[model samples]
Every structure is written in C-alpha cells, then in structure tokens.
Target chain A: MMFYINQTSCISPQEFILFDDNHILRKATGGKLFALEPNYKNIPSAQLRRMGKAVRFGVGAALPLLQQGNDVNGIIIGTANGGMEDCMKFLKQIIEFDEDSLTPGNFVQGVPNAVASQLGLLSHNLGYNITNVHRGLAFENSIIDALMLLNEHPLNTYLLGAVDEISDFNYKIELLNGNYKQQSNEGTDFYESGSQGSLAGEGASMFFVSNKKDAAIAKLEFVETIHSSDEEEILNWVEGRLGSHLIEMDKIDLLLTGENGDNRVLKYYTAIESIFNNKISIARYKHLCGEYATASAYAVWLICELFKNSKVPLHIMKVGTPPQKIEKVLLYTNYLGEQHSLMLFSKVK
Target chain B: MTAIVVTGLGIISSIGNSAEENRESLIKSRAGISKNNNFYSRYSTLLPFGEIKKSTAQLMEELNANEKGVTRTSLLALHSIQEAIEDSKLTLNQISSSDTALIGASTVGGMCLTDQLFIDATTASKGSEYLSSYDCASVMLYLQNRYKMKGIVNTINTACSSSSNAIMCGARLIKSGLVKRAIVGGSDSLSKFSINGFNALHILSSDICRPFDANRSGLNLGEGAAFLILEKEEDCKGKKVYAKLSGYANTNDSFHPSSLSEDGQGPFLAMTQAIESASLDASSISFINAHGTATENNDEVESVAMRRIFEKVPAFASTKSYTGHTLGAAGAIESIFSVFNIINQEVYSSLNYTSPIEKTGLVPNLNYRKTSVQHVMSNSFGFGGNCSSLIFSKH
Candidate 1:
C-alpha cells in the first residue's frame, strides 16, 4: 500500500524551521542535549504547566501537522524513554516520601502514551491512538502501524510520530550503564572521533500520513525491522523489501546509516555500507541529533528534507557523492546491537 | 483478508493461574479481591487488591528465571506466554521464526520493583541490578529475547487499554500480511508504585470493588498477565479455534487525562465503531465485558455510553470485579474472558454489582448463565482518555 507523508514536523537540536541553513553538529560538553525549544504561546499555560519537556516537544511537533481539527483516524507514537523526567520525579517522590502523599501529576505524565494521548485530547480527534515503546525500534513500529492502518482502510489520515527525552537521572543511569561517554569531544567529525560513548540526545518528530498524494512531502514505499547479526540475513531482508517493490539495489540513490561515532556499534552500519558496494550516496544523522533510541525519527525528518531540497548538509552527510537526482532514500539504524530497522522513502513525483 | 483466529490462550491473574482455572472462577463467581498480603505497602491495611498469591521469588523459582534484573512483571509474562505458546502447539522453530510476532503491553513493567529502581536511580549503590528493568518495554524485551522472536515485536502502553491495542495491532499486522501469527497480551504485577499512584488519585476503594454498583466509590488496583495466540485461518485449519477476532476500535475522549466526558462520547464511539467494523449491528452483541472500573466516573460514563449504543443493552458485566483493574493487562485479560464467553457459550456475572447507576439504570449480568453466545464485545478505557472495544465471535 502507498502512503504519502502529507506533513512533517520535528523538534531537534538543530533548527527545524524551513530556510534555516545553520548547521549545529557538535558533541555536547554537557552530558545531555535537549531539543530546540519551540514556541508554545498558543497552548494554555495551565495545561502547559503540567507537561514535561517530552510532552511539550511531542504536542508541539504534532499540533502543527493537523489541519485545524481535521478528522485524524489514528494517532500513533513511538518513544524509547518517554517522559523520563516525569518518571524519575515520580520515582523519586515514591522513594523520598516513602510512598506517602505523592502527587498524581508526575505519575500521569510518566506514561509512554501520554504524548500521543495528549495530542489526541488537545485536537479532539477520537480516532485510534497507540504508543509503541520498543527501545530502538519504537518509531519504526509507528511507521509499520501507519502502513498497516492505511493498508486496511486505504483512506484514513493518520498522525504518526515519535518522542524521547533525557532526564539528569536518565543520563546518569546511562552513564553508569556505560552506554554513553563521560568525555567531552567535538562531534562535527563524529564519524572519525569520539570517546567510548555517544552523546545523549532527545527529540520528537511527527508526520501526517494518508493515502492521498495531494500536498504530500514524500511517499513511504517500504519499511522493515529485523533482529539479526548475520550479514546475509540483513542483505536478504533489504533485497526482499526492495525486490517486492520491483526496485533494485542500484536504484537506491541514498543510504542513511545510524552511525553515532560509537566504534563498537559501527560494524552494523559498515555491513550495510558494504552491501551497497559503497556506490550509493550515504549520510549520517547522529552527529547532528546525537544517539538515542528513536534518533531514526530525526533521520526520517532529515530524509524528508533531502527530498525537498535535494541537498545533503555537509555537516552530517558522510561518504559518497550526492546523487544528481535524489529519488530514493533508505534509512538503516540499529540500537544496542539488536533491533535493526530499515526504512525506504521516495520522492512522490 | 485472512480471518484472525485465536488458537491458543493463557492467563495468570489474581483468581487463577491458567485459562481453565480463570474460566472456572468466572463460572463460579469467585472474586479475587482481598486485603493485600503477598505485597506490603502503606495502603496494605487500608485498601483491597486483586493480588496474586504467589511471591515473586516463588514465581521466579518456578519459572526458572533466576537472572539478574529479572522483575516480577517478566516472570508473570513468561508464565502466561509459555502457556500460550504451548497451548498453540507451536514448536521451538516456529516460536523463533521470523513469521511469528510477539506484541506485549504493560504500564508498571519493572517499576513494580519500585524500591530497587529508587535505590538504583538515587544514592547509586553500585547501581542496583534492577536498573534495566524499569522501562515499559522491559518485560516485552525479556520475552522476545527468551523466545528469540524476530517478527515485528512491539510494546504498547495506553494505560488500561494497552493490551487490547496490542491485540488489535497484532491482528492488523496479520491482516496486512506482515506476520503469519502473533502472540499478543500484557503483564503487570502489583507494586507499591501503582498502589500508591492510584491511592494518590483518590480512586482506590477500601472495600472490594463493586463494579456497576450505584454507590460504587472507586477502583481496587490489581495486576496479572494474559496472552492469546492469534493465527490466520489458513494456519489454524485443524486447531482448536476459540473465537474469531472480528472487529476492534479505539477512540479518545479528548476530554480529560483521567476522566471520561459526562456524555461518554469516547466509549460510545468505540462501541459503535467496533460493531460497525464487525459488520454487525449493535443488537448482535451477545454480551459486553464493560470497562466498569467501579470508579465513580467510569461506571456511570460507561453506562451512558452503553445506553447510547445498544438500544437494549446486551447482557454486560465488568469482570474488573473478578480481576481488579489490571491496568495494561486489563485489556488482554478481559479479552481472554470475552473469548471464553464465546467458547463456553456462557455469560459470567459481574461480582458485587448491586443497583445500577441512577442515570442510565443499567444492570449488568448479575448471575452466570449458560446461553448461546455468538459474539462478545469487550471494552477497555485508559487514563489518557483512550477507550477501545473488541468483538470476538464464535468460530
């Protein structure tokens, strides 16, 4: 089934507004990197006060994609560590107060679906709302859900998105777990230089998808996920997805890898790079967005940008000359040496 | 489109450990709510809960899941998922195949081990071993690793309607030819975190929850796990098909974070949409497993919604009285009950239900009855104004 991306919105470290040519790609001296703050002057301050950073980013990213109270048939979200600040606050309250007189606000905000449901509650769209919280594959799950929904109904406008946040506690926990580096380093050359850990980053992206091709930003042709270490398995998965769509390996003009300057996890991307024979134009996003579970959501947003501009930002794109006519872009990201996800987007000409 | 068939069933709840045991409790009108004993909390002496009798250690020992960072949520999930895979007669190869998908849901997850999480996140004494168990997807990832499931594994958390959404997502994946079969359900073990969280909401009933009761005060928090093995009709040709997942719908109240609208628009739309999806009229519904949370807000709103949908409301009951609100697991746990209604051709009573709400004047099925039940509609509403309904028809 063909699904068109009607609109896209994202809140990341880099300015997401159109015509913003600023390239801010540097590893954080601080441990955590926050998404660029979006103006929320329109939302009620009372309701806004109760939300956390993640909720604000999610609602901020989603509210703009809707067509002023349009009947959105589904609201699907993907998040790795949703509302971590609220979750940690609630957890802290439970521990400090010894389970006595705890506020309900933190607990309410801690839910993974809080962002999606909050969007639905705000827009008054009583359609299907679900939140996928599968570590690295969270946003990919949302894509699959959007595809399945469109395949089943073929005429429904759906809101699909992802969100994640980093709390001080979340950052500390990751640091203790050795998932991120404590050392500060410039990330512009993230592919060549970095410590043992990748910089922790958080962001949110929302897409309005439907069967209608009118006013679409891009067309999503294929998406798949696999948990495998076998090179042949990965190759076969990609080949099968492209083959079923009657596309070939050489037709894939660009490949987006989820390499985040972490040498340990770079092998997965290297394997994919080998499959494309180093011929396809390849780019990287983690240098700009840093490393997080749903960082691929940011990669997808970047893909939409490449489709619109046909220009790859030099600060993040790595290896291979840019294709003269960017037609098809493939995204490959793996989290924690497991959960490998691949997505293919094509310009809807 | 291939019909989604329920070929296997598993359950571990406060009242029972297996599907058959739960079925028996349903028929016998056994209520599981009691003073919290297995788990200790500040509200242990004050509120009743549907706490399973087994201790966490005992569960881990029995399941042979003695590993670092293994939480009670994973243990409960393992028990139910193992039962489901076995009941489906699936081999190890099939369990590990890329054609099989596992969709699990849970809200508490490892947060059930609140003390360990607290210590791990705080003071940081060698970072407690349970640090990795706190996310909503921990239990699901643990199960996926256990079975080596590779096909579209996902975790969903929409509060009370989580597992129902998981089940719906699984079926949609199958219908879209993404997977051949899916093991779908949710698990949540009772913990001080949820108990205190609900207590803070001022919705924890001190007595056993009286769902649909006119004087119903609040809900009693509970936890457990339940799973269903759903396969395409072609794959389950000769299998024991319990029921067909005919239709499902989810709608948002868009009204509040924790409360439904006074008109019950969310529940009403969910019920009507689900029936319409099944290509069946509202009157075709034989029974309804209402989302009667027994809270002052939920019961009345659900009744109003039911009145708006079913001209003559079908024989409906809130099994939440049997298994206190299981949060993320409530959807799947009650879905299993709905399937059992189709399989056994019986309608179980809503335990402790007294007079109906004065506004709608709707009384649930107060007694168990053996009848010809063709379709059973189950409802699950969550804190985010997420309301979902699923229709299961006899195969």
Candidate 2:
C-alpha cells in the first residue's frame, strides 16, 4: 500500500516552523543545537508548564497538521532518548534524596511514549496508538507502523512522527562516548574537517499520513530499514529491494546521504555512492539539522520541502548534475555504522 | 491467509525460570510476591514486589556474558530469547537471517541502572560504560549487535501493553509478507525509577496484590522477561505448535494518562474487535488471561469490560498473582500462561481473592482444573489507556 503525506509540521534548529517560509536558515555548528521554539499560545499554561522539551515540541508540531474535523485512527511516535531532561532529573532525585520522597511529576512524564499519549489525550483519539524507541531507526519504524495501519485499515488517517531532545546531561554523555565533536565547526563543511565526531542536535517532525491522495505534499513510495555494517549485506539488500520493486538503479533520481562529518560512519554512504558509480545526484542534509537518532525524520521533512519547492537547498553540496526531473528521491542513512535505513519518496504528480 | 502459530515459548519470572517450571508453579497455586529482598531497594521493607532471585552477577555468570556494560534487562531478555530460539529449533543461520524479525518491548530498558545513571550525571568523570545503556531501545540494540541479527529490529514502549503490541506488530509483519518469522517479547528488571514512579502514583500495593477482590489495594510492581517464537503454520508443520495467534486489537481510552475510563471503552473495543477478527463468538473462548494488575481501578474496570463482552465471563484468571506485574513483560508472561492453558487443557487459578467487587459481581476461576480448552483471549492494558487484546486458538 502506498502512503501519502497529507500535511507535515517540523521544529528544528532552522527558522522555518512548518513548510511555509525559509528566509533564515541558521548554520548548525558542532556543539549542541536546539530546535527553534514554537509559540505555545494554543496550549493551556498549566499543561504547557508540565511538559518537557519532547512533549512540547511533539504536541506543538502535531496540532498544526491535524485537521479540525478529521478523525485520526492511529498515532505512532518514535524517540531515541525520550524526555531526557525529565528522566535525568528523576535519576538525580533518586540518588540525591537517598531514594526517599521522590517527585512524581518527572517520573510520570519521563516515559518514551509520553508524547504520543499526551497527543491522544489532548485530541481524544481513541484508536490504535504506539511508540517506537529504537535509535537511528525509530522514525523509520514509525513509518513502517503507519504503512501497516494504512494497509490494514485503508480508510484510516494516521499521525506519525519522531521527537528527540539534547540536554546538558545527555550531551555530556554523548561527548564522553565520542559521539559528538567537542570543537566548534561549520556543519555544512562537516566533511572538510574529517572530524572524529558529528554535531549534536535535537528536533521533532510530525506528518499526517493517509491512504487518500488529496492535499498531499509527496507520495511515500517505499521505506526499508536494515541493521547491518557489512558492505556486501547492505549491497545485497539494495539489490533485492530494487529487484522486488522492479525499479532500475537509474530510475533513482537523487540519493540523500546522511554524512555528518564523522569519518568513521561516512564510509557506508561512500560505499553506496560507489555502487551507483556516483552517477545519481547526491545530497547531504546533516548540515542543516546536525545529527541525532531520528535525524532522518528531519531529512524526510527536508525532502518534502524540496519536492514542494522543486529546488535543493543552497547549502547542500551537490555531488553530480541535477536530474532532469526529480521524480524519485531515495534517502539512505546509517548511524555509527549500525542501523541503516532507506526511504523512497516520489513526487505527487 | 497464512495462520500465525506460536511454536515456541520462553519465560523467566520471579516464580520460575522456564515455561514448564512456571506452569508447575501455576498448577500448584504458588505466589512469587514477597518483600523485595533479592534486589537492592529502599522499598524492600515497605513494599512487596515480584523480584527474581538471581542477581545480575549470577545472571552474567550463567549466560557467560561478562561484558562490562551489559545491564540486567539485556541479560534477562537474552536468557529467554535463547530459550525461545532453542525451543523453536532454529539454527544460528535462521536466527541471523534477514527474514527473522526481532521486536522487543521494554519500559525501562537499561534505565534500571538508576544509581549508575545518577552518578554519571552528577560526577565529572569522562564516562561510564553504562552511558549508552539508558533508554528503552538499548536492550534491543544489544541483542541485535550480539546475535548479528540482520532482520528488521524494532522496540516498542507503551507502558504495560508494550509487549502485546510487539506481538501484534510481529504477526502483522509476517502477515504482510515482510518476514517469515518473528521473535517477539519484552523484558524489564526491577528498578528504583519505576518503583518510585508507581509509588508516587499511589498504585504500588504494600501487601501482596489481590485482583478483583473487594479489598483490592494497589499493584505490586514486578519484573521479568518472556518471548514467543511466532511462525507460519505451513513452516512449523512438524514443530510443536502451542496455539494459533488468531486475533488482536489495540485501542486508546483517551480518558486519563494513568487511569481507564469508567465504562472501559478501550478494553471493550479491544476485546470485541479481537473476537471479531478471530472469526469467533464471545462464547467460543475457553478462558481469558486478564490484565489484573490488582490495582483499584484496573481490576474493577477490567471486570466491567469482561461483563460487557461475555455473558458468563468465561473461566478467566490473572497470573499476576504468580508473576506480579511485570510491566512491559506482563503481556508476554500472561500470554504464555494463556498458551499453557490451551496446550495442557487446564485452567490456572487466581490467588488471594476473597470477594468480588460490588460493581461488577464477577468472580474469576478460583481453582486449577483439567478441562477442554479450545481458545483463549489474553487482555493487556497499560498506562495512558493503551489497551490490547489477543485471541489464541487451538492449533
């Protein structure tokens, strides 16, 4: 079954709130990059104060895409470290107070599915709801869930998205584990540094997906996720997918790679580039959004914007000549050479 | 349509370490709830829990996993996952193949190391090995890396119903021709985070939990892991097919974050829809493994839902008396109990029940007995009003 994106809302470090205007595209550096805050005038003050970054962004991004009268039969969300700020606070409380008289607010709101559940409660969506917490592949897993929901119930509209946040505690852990670069550097020129780590970033992206093609920004042709580090395994996966879909390599108009200046994980993207003989136009998106577990979701939102505008971002370094017609865009991303995901998006013509 | 069958079952909870042992405990009406002495917890003296006897070091030694960063959650999951793979007779090649999907559910994951996380956050040390093992997906990632699994691996966290959704998602994936087989289940070890959280909610029972009873206090927080190997009937022709996973439905109550609606609409819809999907009548089910958390709201609402669905409310029992509330693993653990009912043609008794709630006037099966069992419906409801029901029929 084919899935179409009816509406999308994104909150990233970039200035654009949704898919409207993109006048100020800020440069994401190697240090921590937080998403641009959105207005929360729609939510009650008490409820907004209780929510953490993930929930605030998640609800803020989702409310705009949901139509007033339309029924949402499903809600699926993805997050790597959900409500990290609250979780850390609870952990510290547990230790500081000698595990006595702990606060309930942090503990209650720290769960990974809090965002999805909050949305359900806010909108009174009494349908199938779930959350995936896999790193790197979380958003892809959400897409998979949405696809299955559409296939099982063709008439249902689903809300699918991902949210992740970077707190001081989480950032320190990432820095210690050699996941983020300590030195500041321009993200657009990430590969030029040949740095050991990528920039730390956080964001939330939500999409209103439906089987009906009305009011859609793009058509989700296919989405696949594979956990493999071996080059041959990944190549075999690509080959099998192409053969099963009956699509030639040349039919792929553009290749979106997640190259975020981390040389250790950049080889996987390079291998794919070589397999296609560097023929297809390759585009990079980590510069604009930095890197996170669900950064690929941001990349997907970026693709939707690209399709709507019919032009690539000026900061995205082009590898080859642009295709005559950008009909098929295949996104390939791998994090720390562990979880590899691919998503194929086609223009809604 | 290809029928999805459960060919293998694995479980390790406070009562027993394997399916047969747990079944024995069930038949003998054994309860594993006690003071939380086995694990380090300030609530050890104040609250009761279903904590496994084995320590993390013991688990590591038995599993031969001396890795520095491995957490108790991962170890528990690996123990059951290995048992499941062995019970299914799947070789290394099959498990590591691209067609075998692994879907794990966990509410706490490595966050069970709450103390260590607190230390890491407070101190200025460069890092501890436990840094990466802090989210709900860490255990799944550990398994993926350890087993060299190449299939689609995902993690689900919807509070208590996490594993039930995992099982449903796994079956759907196979039905959609995405994979040939699935290793689906969840694991959760006792931790201070959940204990304190549940304590704050005033839901953690100080005494042993009593489900559907008039004096039902609160729920005793528990922890363990259970996994089921699901494959198509055609592929498992000669294998021992325990039961067929026939129907499943997930619904949200949208009433409260921590409580269900008064009418139990989520539970009602999930059960009725599952029965419909199974192509069976409400009377066809032989038994039901109820999501009896022993909390004040859950048992009452669940009983009301049962009354709405079945006129007689078939021979139903809550195995939480034996396993406590295993959180993410509750669904899979109760599911295994339901399968045991189908295979052995017996009904396990519910313990610590003196009187039924005045509202529902429903009483569960109070004694274990050998009987003709054909189909069983398992209910798993979670926080945030996430409710799921699965129907398993005799294969």
What TM-scores do the predictions have? 0.97, 0.97
Q: Distance from true position, residue B135, model 1, in Å?
A: 0.8
lDDT of 1 by residue, B1-395 (tens): 67899999999999999999999999999988887887668888788889898999999989999888899999999999999888989898988888889899998899888777777676756687776788888898899888877788999888899999999989988888888899999999888888877887899998899999999989988889999999998887677888999999988888888889999998999999999989999999999999999999999999999888878999999999999999999999999999999988899999887787899899889999999999999999998889999999999
Pairs that clash in candidate 1:
A27-A187, A181-A197
DockQ of 1: 0.73
Docking class of 2: medium
The residue-level lDDT of candidate 1 at A259 comes to: 86
Kindly list the per-residue Cα lDDT of model 2 for residues B368-394, writing each as its tens digit.
999999999999999888899999999
Model 2: residue A16 alpha-carbon error in angstroms: 2.4
lDDT of 2: 0.87
**What are the Cα lDDT values of the candidates?**
0.86, 0.87
Give lDDT tens digits, candidate 2, residues A1-349. Answer: 5799887889998875333334555666448777888787767789999998888988888877664566788799999877889888887777778778777888778888889988888888888999999888999999998998898889888999999998878888878778888785854565667878888888999988998887688898888888887877787787678678777789888888898888778778777777789778898877677889999989888888877777665456458765556778888898777898877898786
